[model samples]
Target chain A: MKSYFVLIFVAVFMPVAMLAYSIVPKRLRGYVLLVFSYAFLMIMSGRPVVYLVAATLITYVTGLTMGHFQARRDAQLAEVKKGKKAIKEACKRTNRWVMVAGILLNLGMLFALNYLGFFAQVGSGLLSLFGIDKTFEPPLWIAPMGISFYTLMAVSYLVDVYRETVKPDRNLGRLALYLSFFPHIMEGPIARYSEIAQGTWEGNPINRQNLYTGFMRIAVGFAKKLIVADRLNLFVDPVFDDFSLVNGGIIALAAVLYTIQLYCDFSGCMDVAIGLGCIFNVSYPENFRQPFFSLTTSEFWQRWHITLGSWFKDYVYYPVSLSKRVKRLTTMARKRFGNKYGPLLVSSIALFCVWFLNGLWHGAGSQYLFFGMYYFVLIWLGGLIDPLARSLATKYGIDRDSKPYRLMRRVRTLLFVFVGELFFRANDLPSGLAMFKRIFTHFSLETILNGKIFNIGMDPADFIIAGIFIALVFARDYAYEHDHNLLAMISGKNAVIRWAAWIAIVMAVVIFGAYGHGYIPVDPMYAQF
Target chain B: MRDQIIEILEDINPDADYETCTTLIDDRYLDSLSMVSLVAELEDTFDITIPAVEVTANNFNSVDAITKLVERLVEEDED
Candidate 1:
């Protein structure tokens, strides 16, 4: 009940839900999904499920209202040739207001539930700075499960409707199911209305091909979670929790391990989510695209948590950067600085907003903000330096696209990512800074030289197991990066090979998974956010 | 108009074969920063408002796509 990986959910709840969904008539299948979605939400967050309902209702009403105005506008346009411009302008203005109101309402709820307390604490701290003794008692709010995921989806849907990219769903139940489909409710690919809503509503029966592919994908997710991520957690958690006890070398190693742990854990969960969606004949968008293979920080964001990045790009970045005021600034700056640096200067304003909100969206924490700013600075600097770098390479007769150069860039990007994740995983901004400082100031190889590395939570055997699995995962990602779809390749193979692959995955998880005796199963990492 | 659009693309990022490359965005030839510069240049050059909604792959993925988008927006501006 707590997470998708739990035995109760995996063994009991999913089987029952799938059975019920399969047995239900085609006409009632969507309702069945709606019912289970709500039931899952209720079990997870109880009364807070009301917030999801409120969001769905607000989105539904907003869409219909805009639709109504659009209809009227079209009718009037059809009836008249003169004054059509004025009529269209009037309707556009009204719909804009309606869309803005809907967006604000949805975002307002999210802010109250997730961010109010953090902001209040900051407010109180500022007050005390001026010799004020009074403190504002922030409300304790239990956010509904997947509030972050769903709210973004809700806003995307609303905006898409306003943009006429997606027609508003008049069917409340369909919209409800789109928002609350149990698989994506927890950690989402932040699916758009246009992406999977129709397929979801169609409720196509679970054909054998889909079922096999879905189960195979789920098995891969389980293998990733059980074997690699959980095992690494044993070493990663304690180091982060008690970072001060370890030297810089160990701290550095821990950071690298932590980044791997996080990728596996988060992407593994996404695999399960998408697999479940596949079982139900809905294809959730891919969230991770071999993020480790990216060569630049900007490219890394494009690859990692892809939906979230694209969400910000479509909703926040493009809008802010292309707004009238920013566009005017861009024009002015471009005139002054020329084509390369001018628009970039203005675009930085929009980039700053994206990173600032991106940080806050993770959680109301200073470290998260710092993490966002870290990437922002790196990306902006990269943009600023790219032209110079390219010119220098040309002047020096260096091949920027050569494998060595690409490898160097990938390593550099990974180093940057490791540091960012250090801040992201640290207790706070100060702790992150302290740990980072130690990496350079208190550097040492004594931990490895003295055989102390193995003593810190993970033995040599643990390392071997984790290393083997990590390599396997890396190979799979490498194949994917090269356009080799492992699943498809397997699916197209003979029964013996397919069955062997499945059995190997299952046997690996059952045998080498970091559970049972002393291992603590890590909760789905991205679920908290 | 098409030639002017190609000039803008060349100025933005001359690495690609704009005449034949249709995967400018898809292949990362036109990164986000490049997209921003391209949009601003196109707007200033054409004297048309390119709203954020029009900044999709279908509109900016190639020389032909960018030419069509600018022409369409220019037409809309006239209307």
Candidate 2:
């Protein structure tokens, strides 16, 4: 199930159609792109094509209806501006039902599809009380690939349109393309209308620069996926699969390895999406900026899943922070409890809920819930108590910004991130909690040096590979962070050198990548999004 | 208007000043989160809807740049 051919077909066709879209008349661009989107969906889904079509239809109808309503409102607003003033709120009230309906329809489809397992258990429990002990499970749990993803796109579009941040797409065809942009259908950087409405449907000619960059990026992404992510998975699978046999030392090592693997896996897919966007000459936000180099959990979050964080901030944090209740609570806390601690305390509770919600967004499990709260607690405690530590350090006359303090903070941050990730990577809450216990109580350094983990599925050679790759990753970041012109340096070289470097990168993937080695090639994890 | 914009910028990024901070969007001095807040503030302060097209790097470069951008957008609406 490579599903590889769909990508091959798509790589050839998408940009050509986009070029065709550029020359096409205004009326047909939307329709042509829409057909392409559906065709793209059909090829990817192969056997179960109807679900994506239905999703596309649902979004199309909702967008059209929203557009229709928006057109009516705009007309009304224009009239009012033309001396036929009427209260807009009354008109808004009249159309509010449709908006509410659109939100529910999109959200309902998402939960029903993604959370079928959760509902099945609940349904089974309710029936068991009356002796209906038998269970009902879906014969096919074929969640439309990217159902979660497209569902988010639909919601974001509907919500943005409702907020009038963007006007609804009057044409249904453009709306379908927006919902089912093939590159982003499975995993996402979840482009907003404001991000891409101009280029995505604006009928821009696909330029060579965009095409070259796009495939180059996709090539890099494929290399990361087949080489780095799958290669690392060889080390992680055996360790997690048999936790009892592995010592705490190996478990910790595995967690650290898995953490990087997860990042590489997730970010590698993002490169694919961004590359796809590049081909279309549409800009998608960069979702990863070397997250492994992040110095703190908060910094790690800012770098990792950048879009998800921003999404939560926009959709959840701003609204909650601006709400009258939160505002009043903060104001009162500042006034009554003193400005130093009060508002900070109240915001943490809100922050906790937001993190917890963010965690649960990944999946519906107690483990995710714990993963969310773990951040809530750590970030909260860090915010509230960090000042005291800083103050004490000041009293002792140790420069807080001194190298030792910085090193300590860095170490503490790694521990915080590692432990939080322990819970995140764990199979369940109890498992996560048990792992944490073992790390603290039963920690040992001997096993790592003894090569216990290396003997599993990963060879000693794998460690050498990981070491070289990790060093390169760090060097890449160092160049980026320090603003060294590595890209320019390579490109500035003589033609032969540049070409050689490019070919070497390409050849590395063709030769050493984990695929075609008689081992099952694992898909990038973020594809589940 | 430029002074008011500068005051707002100073609240968010204290190192900012009108002349040095005008190329805000291009320089990536203000992130998207701050961009949203800046938009909200400009909307309330100027009583205008800053169209999406006006949020480009050129128009949102500095306090003076943003004020001029806002002035043009609002004037267009007035016409």
Question: In model 1, what lDDT does residue B14 have?
Answer: 73
lDDT of each: 0.90, 0.68
- On TM-score, the leading prediction is 1
lDDT of 2 by residue, A1-529 (tens): 2332124554667557666677888656656666766676676666555666676666667666766766786777776655333445554554556666776777777677767786687689889999988797954455667777776677677767666678767665566677777667767887777787666676556675566567657666766676677788887887766676767887888788887778767777887789878877779888887665555576667677877776665666555544557656755765676544665666665576679777767776667788888887776676567557757777898886577877777777877777777777777888777877776677787777776656777777767776676566568767876778565566567767766766776677677676665445786576554
Q: Scored by Cα lDDT, where does model 1 land?
A: 0.90
**DockQ of prediction 1:** 0.88
lDDT of 2 at A451: 65
- Residue pairs in candidate 1 whose N, alpha carbon or C atoms collide under 3 angstroms: none
TM-score of each: 0.98, 0.80
- Tell me the tens digit of each residue's lDDT in model 1 across A219-292: 89988898999999988888888888889998999999999999988999899999999999998989999999
Model 2: pairs clashing at backbone N, Cα or C within 3 Å: B22-B61, B22-B62, B23-B61
